[model samples]
Target: MLDTAALKEFLQQQLPANLELLKSMVEINSFTTNKDGVSRLGKMTAEAFAPFGFNADFVPSLHPDYGDHLVMTRKGTGTKVIGLISHLDTVFPPEEEIKNNFQWRVAGDKIYGPGTEDIKGGTTMIHLVLTALQKFAPDVFEEITWVILLNSSEEVMSHDFGKLCIERLGADALAALVFEAGARTGNAFSLVTARKGRAVYRISVEGRAAHAGSHHERGANAIVQLSETIQKVAALTDYSKQLTFNVATVTGGTVINRVPHFATAEGELRTFEREIYNCGIEKLLALSGKGSVCSAEDGHPSEVKIEVTQESPPWPRNNGTDRLFSIFSEVSSELGLRVVREERGGISDGNFICHVMPVLDGLGPNGDNGHCSEQSADGSKEQEYIDVTSIIPKAALNTLAILRLAQSA
Candidate 1:
């Protein structure tokens, strides 16, 4: 039997110290591309769990520009494992952080910072939960080994990190919990049960360059043709099927006078269902071919090429995920917290690990305005913030949830 009242009291007592740690973490900028900064934050995070008997190891990324992924493991008497996942990186670069003047700030119950809502707070929440379990529920803490994965390139969607997660904890893990920011509506908080998959594509066009004024008709305009194709591509978005296409970046033409020889556009496709995802991919790939630009009375010398740069599969809700949520919700009700299951559109590490083991996400603090940084006088343009009050209760909930999961297994 567990003492819920005493556990809640312990979490409430540690609120101030946990908030201070979160502030310290927010002060350090851990942009995905900043290897040094990300590594520094990883070092600090690893030290926090060291006192609880976790041994930390840094795995180098596939590319040298990104920070090494941090994996911390605490051994237990049993071989069954429970994995907790979070990221150390934020979307904001050093320049954006400086320009937007986005640092940690406290006002009433909200703490605004760069990575506060997206994930840094989630990592801090992990520390708080494990600390509570170690002190209050010692038997539960020792029942299963804990595997903590804090990848450094989650903001940019690193495929290697997904593989690393499976290689480490996929074999015998009981359940994987992702600590992305949670959502609170009225009295109930939301836990993510499913997430949409995403694919990135780049389209390149080749044409002939010619003088604008002297030989306009003799030239092949790649930019114009690409723009026309982009319209067709953007029209692929179908709200009915929950499929969306975004033409993110476009680049074409060297000068204003000449008909440019090259053009390119980058876009993304996202969907909840696998059938829709595959269908969208097929249509996007089929668009690669010749363009409607001609070369001086000859045949059209323009060509288009489409490439899928990266992809992450969707994690649809299933029996396994529902069972995990049922277990978690029972614990929440016992602790006086109401939780609801949600299907989020954003991608996370759960999308990769769900197939390896049953996964549950949104186990972190509640907040809004995840990637926004600008601020306005009317309080419309809001920066990212974490609900200061939700931290302790969520930590207590997660602590009890983990305990019940281990004991039930």
Candidate 2:
């Protein structure tokens, strides 16, 4: 049996040092576009984890504008490998942080700063859990290989980072745990078991341009055709399958007096099931070049083209995910930490690797108001923050659960 009380006490004693580390990270602006800032934060993280026998490998991003992805590994005596996932970037820009004056501020129990709850807290949680495990559960720590993946472009949705994770962790990894900020509601804690996938697409329509008054009957109106097609795409949304589409942007004519020759629309689709997402995609694609527009008998017909700009495949909850959740639940119950599983509509790094292995996310500390820099002195407005008091219990919970998982595997 593990000494849960002792682990908690040790975590409590180390909270100050952990906060200091978190403060240092929060002070550095690591916006997704800020490659230099992201790399600096990754270096700091590597130095922090070096004490645990982990070495860092900096993999360059496919995008030259982004920072390199960090893959840190610690070899153990056993064959089973466990993957830990988090992002090094936040949504807040340097100008935004400075404009809002949202530096590290500690209230009664809340710690407010950029990236405090979204993900940097999650990275700090990794260090805290490992510190406790190294001190109290050294045997378990030495029995399994630990691979940590820190993304530099998660906010922008990773295309190369996902492949890099699979290459480093391999498909045979025991499980992947994502630290994306857990939730504490009253007495129960929540961890995410599923996340919805997302895809963005642009539709372009081309036709013959003409003057509205003089040549209206001789032209094919592309904007009118696109408007009719947009309704078809929007109608594909099904609430039962948890699938939906949104036509986010539209641009076409230079003036109201002309029949536009070209028009374009952009939108996104989201769902938790791959089959449903694929079906929706197929239906959307089938609509290309199938709609009607006002055109003369001899006029050129309008042509429609659809292209996918970006996509992150869905991560649905399955048996493997449930089994992993059960392990964490058992360990939490043993340690008097009651936990529940949650299905989130948001996507994470878990979506990329869940198919390769079982994935359990939301393992970070409790916090609220993510991606916002607003705050009010009268407690009216909210800002990004982590509950300072929730850190020790969450660390203890993660430490024991990881030990149990490694032992059972």
Candidate 3:
């Protein structure tokens, strides 16, 4: 068994350090597309890991202008490698007026900021856990091999660097733990078992324009056809299988006096099953249809086109792998925490790692309002955020115990 008292002391010491690091990181403003900020954060991360005797390296993405991905590893005696993944990017865009708004406010126990709850807090937790392991259980680190993966982009469908990180780390990992924000209720530590797959698409319609005052009957309206297609696609929702299609954006019409010549609709679909996703796409494509009317004098006819793009693969649930869960639950129980399992419609880097190894996610401080300015740490009656942080050492202890068990297995 791990030494609970020593672990607690180690966590207490590391929490303040993590807080300081997080504040610095937040000040840097590593937005998804900001190459300079991302590269800066990567260098800072490499410097931080150097003191632990780990070799840190940055793998630049295919796009030379974007921020590079980071992979930090400490090789040990075992062949079984476990990975902890987190992202440095925030969803906020650079062009937005509030781009540099990293100012944080403390309302009682709740900390409010842009990236605090979504992931910066989680990143701090990950650093704290590793630092505690390095301090209290140095021998455990020697027994097991592990890596820390920090991606530069995850907000914009992971774009390029996220996928590249998966290709680099997937083959060698025995298991992965994602450090995303925890559940709404602070008392429950959720082991995310499943995530929905996503696909983005754009549908375009073309029709002949005509004078609204005279030749209206000779023209075909593209906007009307596109509207019908949107409704047809929205009808593909299957709640039982957790498949859904949302029509996020639509644009058409130049003026009220003329029939619109073009129209475009953009949307995404999420599903838990692969076949369901395929079927939904087929249904979406079948909705494209040209209108009946056309301008004879101009020799222009109505047309419809559909384009589909695969953004990210769905992360299916692991029905058979209970070893990691058993260990996590055992450790959390030992630390006096209640463990729970959850399924979400969202996607994370864990989706890629889970394909090769057992993965658990949402293991950070509890918070809500993920993508809004009103985002605040969940400080309900339970005081879950602080409680979760207080048990950081115990979670780190659990992680070490699991790593030791995997090394032997």
Candidate 4:
């Protein structure tokens, strides 16, 4: 049994301290592409955790072009290990208008700022929890080893850095807790039991160009062929199996008066099941045909080409194994909160970890409008958000308690 009350009080005192750190981090604009900014934030995080006896290091990812990731650990007396994962990157491009606009204002108990709620808030919560454990529950900390993983490129599908983090840390991890922004107020913390797989693709069509009025029968229309291909791709979606295909963009027409010689469409497919994904891909690739001819160009014929890229694998729920879920639910209930378990259609770093261990995500402070201009500008709806500065310490204490239990077992 963990001392929930003592942990709560310790967190209440440390919230202010964590808030100050979060404010500084928010001001630093650590967008995934901003290498300097990301490195600075990583160093700052490492420095903050040093006093708590954590062996913290800023690990530059193996990806040559991505920003730095932070890996921090506190070794316990026992060998059973637990890992906490979060991303330092927010979903904002460098050229965006709101870049570096890190103004935080409190309106009726809610804090608003770039990266405040989406993830910086969650990171702050992790910090407070770990710090509190070091101060108030040294015995518990000494009994179990814990690792904190903060990646730099989670916003852009986490690319190479995410894979490196998982491959390195997933081998021995008992379970992973992903501190993505969580839900507000209700005991409803999503366990992230499952996630959909993603596949991005670029499709191009080639055809002969000709003047619409002069050589109407001499050119093949790439646009027409591409449109037919798009429909075929969309038709592959199987709603019953949660498979979906979307053609997000199309480009390549020189002028309206001329028959299109080339066109390209970019999109993605998402599915919860591997078979569904494979089936959809096969169908998408099999689509063929030069639909119609705007002109009769004897020398050139229309052609369609597609390139497929796998974004992330599916994270399936272990319906049979519920040790982590059960412990987390019980702990949240004891803390006077409702624990909600749900599946998300989207993907996260959890997908990578799920390949190796049972991962529970959506544990950070809750917010909406992720990856949008409004969310990026104001940090989601402040009023409806939970202050991790208060909630996370309790969650962390509960996690420590769970670690203690695992060690004893």
Top model by lDDT, which number?
A: 2
**Candidate 4 lDDT, 48-149, residue by residue in tens:** 778766797677776666777878888878766778788888765555525433356565556666677668877877776667666766776777677888
Of candidate 3, the 10-residue stretch with the lowest lDDT total is 379-388
lDDT, model 4: 0.71
User: How are the candidates ranked when ordered by TM-score, highest leading?
Assistant: 2, 1, 4, 3
Model 4 TM-score is 0.88
The residue pairs in collision within model 3 are 197-314
- Please say which candidate is ahead in lDDT: 1 or 2: 2
The alpha-carbon root-mean-square deviation between model 4 and the true structure, to one decimal in Å, is 3.3
Over 4 Å off, model 3: 93-102, 170-172, 184-186, 289-301, 319-322, 374-401, 404-408
* Global lDDT of each candidate: 0.89, 0.90, 0.70, 0.71
**Candidate 1's residue-wise lDDT over 86-131, tens digit each?**
9999998888988888999998999999989999999999999998
Worst 10 residues of 2 by lDDT: 290-299
TM-score of 3: 0.88
Where model 4 places Cα greater than 4 Å from the true spot, the runs are 93-102, 288-300, 319-321, 372-401
**Candidate 4 or 2, higher lDDT:** 2
Instruction: Provide C-alpha RMSD values for all models, in order.
Output: 1.7, 1.5, 3.7, 3.3
Backbone clashes in model 2, listed as residue pairs: none
Q: How much is 111 displaced in model 2, in angstroms?
A: 0.9
Candidate 2 on 229-326: residue-level lDDT in tens? 89999999999999999999999977888889889999999999999989888888888874477578574789988888888999998988998889
